[model samples]
Target chain A: MDRGKISKWLKYPEKMGHKYSLWAIYFATGCGIMEIPPVLTSRWDAERFGVLPAATPRQANLFLITGYVSVKTLRPIVRTYELMREPKYTVGFGSCPINGGMYWDSYNTIKRVDKYIPIDGWIAGCMPRPESIFIAVTKLWMMIDKGAATGYIRYRENYRYYRENQERILGKLDWPPLYPEKMGEDNG
Target chain B: MDERELELFFGPQHMGMVGNFSITLKVRGDRVVEARANPGYLHRGFAKMMEYRVWIQNFPLVCRINVMDPDPYELIYAMGVEELAGIEVPERAKYIRTIVMELSRLASHLAWIWAYGNALGFDTIGQWSMGDRDYIIDLLEFLTGGRIYHIYIWPGGVRRDLPDGFEEKTLKILDTLEGHLPEYDDVFFNNRLFVTRARGVAKITKEEAIELGATGQVLRATGVKMDIRKLEPYAAYPYLDFEIPVREDGDSYSRMMLIREEMDQSISIIRQCFKKMPKGPVYHRVPNPFKWKVPKGETYVRMESARGELGLYMVSTGEDKPYRVHFRPPSLPHGILILEKLLKGASIADVGHIMMSLYIAAPEVDR
Candidate 1:
């Protein structure tokens, strides 16, 4: 622990704790996952920033949607995102997740991942460098400090719209609605 | 009397999985009775997508088809376009292309080692290999702008010549990797636990390998002695002197050993490329990307990628875009066909081990 931010540690210990230990789901969404091995291992060493790969979504709080989300993968993404506990933050890792990057007109890939699921931040590049991952993590820390990284909250508030967006691309999802009470209005 | 079977879905989210690809296994007790490969999670319709993009624009897109090893896709695409348009690559570019492809093969094999290690529950090898892979990635970044997707190999030749001191840096990295091989063997390959676990698991006979379209290490491990570089030479492979390492066991251990041996071959190939590279223009400029129209013809070009034989069949019809583009990635057979066959009687514990030994890159299968 750094002595420089003693007051910060005292005032909001919980937020500070969440800020550091961001366990990301080891989910390889697309080509962007190519950079992940280097980031996690001895080269870039993301563990220095307290970011480590979680085996499952339940164990992870930080979800880095690594690359383009094809329609086939969207269902699993939604399921994984829903499985994570509250205060989970999602960072769209490449240009593809923002607006499809090079695969803009791909027939099977969804253009905006945010339309299906809320993203707290975006790392812009065809495939962002491993160093960019560190930058994104630091930026996420700032967002968390300010209480602005609330994509999970936003997701709950607007679950209907996100579901609608997902249903538009993928036909009726196999699983039940995550928030059943919120689904009382339009049961479709 | 009747027997009950458990339906186990093992991927798309499992830690033991290769990537987005999944397999549905019907298991009785600890042994798998039947296995069905489920792909398309990473599909962006690459072959169809390539048809819509202009000839020059597809260079960047092709490499994304295989995330583990991308340079071969670039080389095959370039070869396809060059053959269609009758463009001759400069002699220097040929050597440079060879060096880049072999370097990519080295990097990909290292990545495979990491995956294989991880699959076998040996996290130590995974850490070491992944860290070692970064050095090669650094070399690639120095030569090309991008680390993962190096859109360097174009129709006529490479995008640019080697940067100053690139040769020296490459040789130094090669020396470092060569020195570390023995340590890798001691920790992972030759370890008693690894040998016992991998020895007879998912063994493939020579006939099964050939019949099922297994290529690269899968085919080579079966004592068949088939290599695209040796059989159908490409780039500067015709000039380089390297042996194709073959093992008779056709087991998981044999495949792993073949990968280790191939890394040595790749290093040697790169060294030969640097020694024999002629000094000249690295690229012969193609016509403007927006206005260029290739002649009406279809050409099929294949090369030995790190995984296996990667082939691309491209057709141009006097338009700015290609009429048809099809890629035969090695993972298709290894991941879907061979995997399903091999998993029939394998224990649940060896699912990941067998998959890694076959070296299935999920993106290649889905793409």
Candidate 2:
């Protein structure tokens, strides 16, 4: 959060014509979690884009599952999606969350997270370049600004398995520290 | 003294681990009595993956085995297939390959620097080092559209030639980096606080390091002048002039210093390769990836990676895909015996420090 970068970002909102403030982004699943740093940093600066990753479900409306989501992680992803208030959005990065790109055949990884949750935007690539991620962010911002039906609200209608099998999916294998925890947990 | 000592598991899920791997340590109070390195946490079956894909297809996948420094995998696999096919890469491509490889070395060293600095509670240096590494990654992306896994180095040569003004751009970046090195030195290298924490933390004699099969920085840290770059000149290394960096401290501080020195050497190597680079085709057309079949032969190529000596041994059964491919990762020695010994008498907080100093990359260990 350098002062120079912050000032530049401050000017981008009015120039880009965005309406949302205090937008919250989430990384519930995938290798895209690796990109969370730069994605949140001043360059990509999700905040300046008017979308900040919220620390809690009570504060967020956007869930950006940037990479792959294994079955073990799907439960948490589903839970996080459900906890967010209405008018929520979801963006999937890389082919992983959409169709399990390289690990499609793996028994552990889910083929299409979309099948489980509604997706607002899809950035395609084995692992989408950071630039593509940026594009996806802009697309997501436009969709949100328009007040369109982006992410799903009915958890029972979609991701029934995720809702039903929470313990089995999320509880298995003691998720690594790198795995995102429920909001308020110290990630470090 | 009573019956025994305290035991602690360093990871598979522990914060101390470099990636997903872990180690179990047995300690008598602060002094370690026994230690064992345990791997295989995030093993994606890389060996089996190689068996399923064609020789060319395996290039990208193989690089993941050592994500920190992937160019060696590119060079190793390329050298093996080139040997099998009896093909000689163009002179210019060879120099280009060396330049890219050395740049990869610099990137890898930067990553280690970041992790090591963070491990010692020096978070600012880690951030600074990582931000600097982004510049190298940007340059790599410019050269070969791919950043992390540059599958550009194929069987015969690179996928494409240096882009327009690639040399000038690279030289400019190098100059910028040269200017920044003094600042980095003031913060991490010459900083008194870092020196105290890292000094005498993990030590091994030259004989012990050799006996334990240490290589690269760990081996060099033990006063061994063994570097794959010096012993085996792959690509255009024969034409380049560089020295293998060695240190006598045999401790974590020395290992850290070794990488710092190595970064300078890598910069020098890249500069030499750029100057001596001849003009010619950047790539020699190889048989189509779909129709390619290597001659029945076995070849082993080793490269001095940021982690250590990464060796790729390929056995071709006269098929499009390799019959057998074995990766001898340096993490094995560093991860196992050397790391196990280093943990002795150190606090649990220093677990990550010991691992970083030894340069035990997890994928390399699992692969």
Which candidate number maximizes DockQ? 1
What DockQ, on C-alphas, does every prediction get?
0.79, 0.11
Compared with the true structure, what per-residue lDDT tens digits does model 1 show for residues B61-146? 98888878999999999999899989999999999999999889888999888888888888888899998899998899999988
How would you encode candidate 2's per-residue C-alpha lDDT over A1-188 as one tens digit per residue? 56775564566654233335535544324435444544554345556566665656667776777666656456556656766766666778777777777665555666777766778778887546667766766666566445553456433333334332454544542433222333234322
lDDT of each: 0.90, 0.73
**TM-score to true structure, per model:** 0.97, 0.78
Evaluate residue B128 in candidate 1 and report its C-alpha lDDT on the 0 to 100 scale. Answer: 90
TM-score of 2: 0.78
Using lDDT as the measure, the top candidate is 1
What DockQ does candidate 2 score? Answer: 0.11
Q: Residue A29 lDDT in model 2?
A: 45
Which stretches of candidate 1 lie above 4 Å from their native place?
A: A4-7, A185-188, B1-3
B-chain TM-score of model 2: 0.96
